[model samples]
Target: MAFENPSRERIGDILASAGNIAIVGLSDKSDRTSYMVAYAMQNKGYRIIPVNPMVDGEILGEKCYHSLAEIPEPVDIVNVFRRSEFCAELAREAAAIGAKVLWLQQGVVSQEAAEIAAEAGMTAIMDRCIKVEEAITMQGRTRKTQ
Candidate 1:
């Protein structure tokens, strides 16, 4: 069977309920898309955990974890900025870490990865930007509203 992304409403609900977002492949450079998206999500009140083996220190004032398994706290969403080819492994890692959602950023899509996440009982979202979704969902709500 083919994979389908969640509805906008479902995505909104997922975003609304999510508090801790573990950003995989997050870049330390300010110009990178991963950095920008993570920055926006952080500003919107989500706890952004930077997951990158390359970085030694913080990216956005938060501790950088080498991998998903290293994050001590529960991760509500595993927001990935890596390429589609890397998602299946990340999906397995996300499942192992008990993440509620596997969100593949824009331009990244993988049916195999989505299936892996779904089989693990997680909401798998592919080819969508979390920052864009958050903005779209928060269209009418005030900043204080969540």
Candidate 2:
């Protein structure tokens, strides 16, 4: 059977419940999509941990780590910005750290990645933009109340 992503409501719940997001392959440059997306998520109250071996010091005022294994604190989400080929290994790392969600940013997807997450009992989201989903879903919830 194929892996299925959680419902939109559940995605919202995951976003709301998660506090820290470890973005693998995150770039320090503002022009980069990874940087912009991570910055937006940070503004939404989620702590952003940048994972990039090329960068030193801080990317977004938070200390950057070289890999998921290096993150000292518990990570709620492991958002990947790397290519599809790299996701499988990331999936294993996410599972190893016990992350709640394994999210592949827009245009990045891997069945192996999703399966790995599913096998490890983690929510897997593929080919989706976390920032877009967070905005749309959260806005819909707000509109319902108003």
Top model number, lDDT: 1
lDDT of 2 at 135: 88
lDDT values for all models: 0.92, 0.90
Candidate 2 C-alpha lDDT tens digits along 92-146: 9999999989999999989999999999999999999999999877864432110
In model 2, what are the clashing residue pairs, if there are any? none
lDDT of 1 by residue, 16-72 (tens): 788899999999999999999999998888899999999998999999999999999
Clash count per candidate: 0, 0
Kindly report which residue pairs in candidate 1 clash with one another: none
| TM-score of each model, paired residue for residue | 0.95, 0.93
The C-alpha stretches of model 2 lying farther than 4 A from their native spots are: 140-146
